[model samples]
Target: MRFVPRPALAAIAALLLLASGCDLLSAEAEVYDSPLSADDRRAPGPSYLQMPVRQQGGAVLHTPSGTRVVRGAYDWWTRDGDLVTAAAGGLLLYGADGQDGRVKDRGLNPDQTGSTGEAISALHYSDRFRIDVFSPDLADRRTIVVPASAFDTDQASGSGAELQLHGDPYTLDGVTWVEWGVNSEDDTLTDHGLFRIEGDQIDGVLRNEPIVRLYPAYDGSALMLLRQDNGEDEDCGGCVVEQDLVELDPETGEVAAEYGMPPGYDRDWRVDAVDKVGDTVAVRFRVYDGEGRDATAQWQLWTYDGEWAEREELAGVRVWFQDGGRLVERPTDPAGSPSTSAGAYPATLTWVPGETGDLSDGEADGEVDGEVLFEPSGATCRLGRGEEFCPQLSTTGSLLPRE
Candidate 1:
């Protein structure tokens, strides 16, 4: 063997290790270059949520370029890949090219605006008796007027009637629908109806049915209405009664089937009707005491297809329906607080697979686990003494996907 200095031998060994590392890296590069089918390749960017700054006015918009602020936005939601924002100035729309497609300033923010990713955006003005509908991209605006006579009733008509929108407008089977109610001068809801809009015209679908909430079945086969069942003409005078989930004919708006609840389901309990996910509809059945305090000792995930079934994997977790037929799941706090509030909490948002048309008898798989999107660090503002205070920022349930 040839004599060699120890230092030289050590230096040579280091060089050999460095060359092997480079070879390993080159091997990895080649493996990555192996042809991946387009279907198998992952999307190019990280998804983001447009969490509303609760105490402040603007929104935090995250694009592939970077995070930017849309100033003066009181609230906002997403449609397609665009933003529908409510600002003190007016409702504004931002497209992918950073174009502001605002259709004239409609005065301060609208009374309300909302949309699911698959549904059209709606700006409701009960005072103005009009609704401005926009396409998913926030383009192609259409204004539909709801006449005062549309809510006319024996006891309510003309000026004495107070028109109120029960909830945000929603779309079912290509038709847009809004819920309207006539409140007595005392502010008591006396009559309510489900109205459908087409072009610039509106028509009633179901009237005065005492429906507390309504959702289109995932398959769009039938409309699900959660209605109160008061006994035999009893004038309980707005007292809470047992509730039933009934299926209604989408076109005729007639009751097609009734899913009865267990007796005393409404004695002192409340139901949070989360929207349909996949082949099932998720609902939160909570209990309260006589004094109207939360008496819910446990949280459970209950879904309804033909009948209600308890889901085991997601028990003790709170689930919210996100746009595009997705469910955002978060572990229930031991103290019994909601994730919708301002605070830092752990959350797991899963996007469930969705199906179209009616699959009334089909089975739905449990949600696949997802990574935690973001932990809300409630309304935060600049702490510096001299700095102009930035708007307090907070995370909201309304999450905007990666832009």
Candidate 2:
């Protein structure tokens, strides 16, 4: 903080107080030939909130060479092998047909799942296939391989033959398969085909379209499911649908094991929505729900580490600029923020007074004459002294820090 003596300013404030009855704009020009009233005054305008920025989703497992394939949701993503989905499409991304005749679609699917705010993601760890169904509104699904003991005798027969996945009578080829189940009628389709699970990625055909989701984090020893509930409107007897944030580690294929979502929310709730900078995961939620007809409080923001470890909150607050927007801050919150278009960061405020070439000497102009006086905070060191025309240099060097 800086300490500034306002003895000269006090005199001018008094003059303004007396002149307050008059139209402030019309009485400007000189104000009795003094500049005191001109200090700390702003020409009403705007808060200029963060503009609407574009959000670009990255590829699954971004490599130095560039994203091999843009990631999308399916019901599969693995060691993230580059699959040649088509012979003509540069990569499976456009569409593909492997040299050996295997065909697959490699396009991104944000809505492959049927519902809005719903995302489908896949995980291939060890030898099992993990599929994640995340709904912005409810609990997700997790399915594991049915144990050998649980395999039915009819499944052993491969009746519908979607690629029959039999754990019993070992086949000549040690490889395990999750076969497709088709009906007896040649005309009717039964189930998805059986796929031979490779190391990471899986190659399975299907009579019906199967969901596909890709990931960008390779070497991703674990698979994590991050959910952000926008607290959308809930019908009937339900209140706003509570959101949950989850992280699944496929490294061990631990089913039913993931981070629990915390309760409470407000606007400014966003994550890496715009730029991909900053290591700290930013989340803006409501801290204080002001008293009103509505329970919703103003949005507050906070940043946390993204490494999925843990950290503690340092401080927090709810602030509004009366101008337009409001900001809430919680310094150490974890990063599981929902998708939003608004920003959670603050903008810079600059104070520049006077036009260039206002200086008499061939030097930088900061002050006018001997009338130099510190503001409430002595943090700034002024230059040039004057009896009445003292200009000021904003505090930029070593000085007090702001809250």
For lDDT, the strongest prediction is 1
| Candidate 1 structure, TM-score to reference | 0.62
Candidate 1's residue-wise lDDT over 1-403, tens digit each?
2112256654675577587763211111000111111111111122234444354444665433456667655444443345556665666665534556665656546665555444454655545466666665554666677777776455564557667665666665556677887766554446678887665556786677767776543323334577776532555666767666655554545564445553335545556544443334455655443343343333455655545567544454444323333344443243343312223333434433342121221122333544444433333333245322223222222111111
lDDT of 2 at 384: 30
Q: What is the TM-score of each candidate against the true structure?
A: 0.62, 0.23
User: In model 1, what lDDT does residue 82 have?
Assistant: 52
After best superposition, candidate 1 residue 222: deviation in angstroms?
A: 5.7
Model 2 poorest 10 in a row by lDDT: 394-403
Give the candidate number with the greatest TM-score. Answer: 1
